[model samples]
Target: MRASLPIERSLTAEQTTALGEFRARWAAVRRSTTPADRSAAEQAVRLAYHAAGLERPARIVWCDSPLALAGRVCRASHDDGGNVRSRLVDHVRRRVASLIERRVLRKVLVAVENSVNPADPLVTAVAEAVIRSVPEPSLSMLGHLRCTGLSWSGVLHAIIAPRGFASCAAGPHDLSWLGVYDYLREVLRLHAETEPLCGLMQLASSVGWLQPHARTCWLAERPNLLCGDARDRLHQADGPALRYPDGWSVWAWRGVEVPRWIIERRDQITLAAIDEQMDVQVRRCMIEIMTPECYVALGGATRIAEDETGILWRRNWLAADAWAAVEVINATPEPDGTRRHFFLQVPANLRTAREAVAWTYGMRAEAYAQLVQRT
Candidate 1:
């Protein structure tokens, strides 16, 4: 007979109702006589328990039928019907107890991770107790450890960086542990008071000596501040630093060499230019563009094919060269005398395709418009 396990935590009224439903279903399944029907019913019972947030025991003893087994055993041993039912109930209790044990261990692991001081006597005692309770640690246990930040609890850990762990080992220069706490508090206060996307690049760039690591750390901690599309732009390598619509710009990495053009045009690349280029492309192609806010709503200067009738400008081509390979396509004229238009074709793999198109179009339009206005 399997030992009965106990529930570790109290269930709410809703969960209690769910558990009762699961028990009734399980009993019905166990009473089914047809082999296929019994098997399917047993599966339904397991699913119900899972829906109630209880994991069934991995191994369960299969019997022809609980009543049949009990009758045979009672007949052979001369036992009463009451004793047989008690033993059957014990099986169900044991399954519940196993689930509770798993839940308690998970709670203990979470408590350990959230503890401010892992060395606290109570924390250490509880952690050790949980660790020792499992006879042979399963992969699920290891997965839990990884998730709860306890995977390295008993292992030697190291953080290897090119500059060594000086900042963490002895703390950063002029900044003690308490001082770092105060600095973070100030940062958080400023972040809350000001617009989320404003001044991130400037603040990170101004943090002398810490510029390289500051941006990475800040983004990691407050990821919710930037939209997903805007955040992804920073990961590209070839383009000039991108400026987000929210007024945040990419922070320049320290100790890495950058092209002169990127440095010169860093402040010139704007989201407005990108949007304008996308607008032009949509108009030229006569194709509806899906604007998911991920790719700069597609606008920008593109290279016109030699046969196209559109105005060709040297300045537009030069600007386009800075971002992606552009080629124009000309199509048959429309009945209204307006020619069917095609936008510039840019290689998809170019990291700066979106930005380049935007910058080029913006520059060309601005230059030509200025000339016309002056004339």
Candidate 2:
């Protein structure tokens, strides 16, 4: 059946469907906002440990949220009381590493790429979903109180994951990769060793982040709140877009992760605060949250120039400096041919829209005006 998948130029025909029948299950797992079912998830973890040839943990720690569990484990991992934790981890599932991961992934890709009806809508839809769902979770958002910020699914799914929880000062990595591989395994039945794959599928359907020790394991509950924008980014306007029962939450605007104050203390978002932000994406989101007109009015900005090039506005940002910016329409049209407007901060001293826009590129206005069209 493995060679039959590609030699026949399809992993499964519509009659032998793989993607359609399996997409819903993986999608549900990825988007699930329900609390973890403790009994089921614990059993799944034990199943994984057994598959890895480790004994079932004698203790189970139930966490209110993945974020909460991650924070706890991370702090404890840092303060290892004289190497006690390290000794336990040495015998845990880290030894169950992947050896046939690449080969398995290659087989799946070849079957899909060489499928008989590669252009079929169902095929295209499933391919897009599978490719886009390869999660790349950011691990650096741990330090700041104010903080913020794959297509190769199977290569990562073959073994017990979070391979080195003992060393991870970093937070949780989601089970999305495991979800993808599980979908493929169940739908297409790609011939790899069965036990590890079955264990992974159970984990994919059951839990969020996990940490295993010799006699004990920690597992986080699923997020109680998960939201996304039309673009499929984590997003919500009124509150934390992603939140767990323990109150660990993330705030975002459109897709940009923002400080919680932008949503909670919105009336206090000042021009100075926005200007002080070094990340332009966060700054833009702050302005949008406050509304551009209100942000400009609050800063006492005055429109200085306007023309085909752009509209320029300037205002005092500090006692010693003026804030200047240009609102330019994108030269490229949208799919429906409407242009989107962009507001770019520029040098305060620039006298005109053309000059301000030109300065953004390290060029003189005279030089910019001669270009055929601007991107």
Summing lDDT over every window of 10 consecutive residues in candidate 2, give the lowest-scoring window: 142-151
lDDT, candidate 2, residue 200? Answer: 49
Q: Tell me the lDDT of model 1 at 44.
A: 37
What C-alpha lDDT values do all the predictions have?
0.27, 0.57
Off by over 4 Å in 2: 1-9, 15-17, 74-107, 110-174, 190-192, 275-281, 300-304, 308-310, 314-375
Cα lDDT of model 1 by residue, 1-375, tens digit: 997444234434553344344333322222212222333333433443343334432322232321222222222211110111112222333444344345345553233223311222221222222223223211123222232233354121211111122121110111111111122123222222222212222222122111111101101011111111232222223332323222323322121222333334444344443344443332222111221121223444343223212332121323442333333334666788775434343433333323334344664434545654686
Off by over 4 Å in 1: 1-232, 235-326, 330-336, 340-375
- Candidate 2, residues 8-113, lDDT tens digits: the string is 2334455246554455556666556777767787777677667666677776787876545555544332112111122232332233224224334556544533
In candidate 2, residue 67 scores what lDDT?
49
Candidate 2 similarity to native, TM-score? 0.61
> Which candidate wins on lDDT?
2
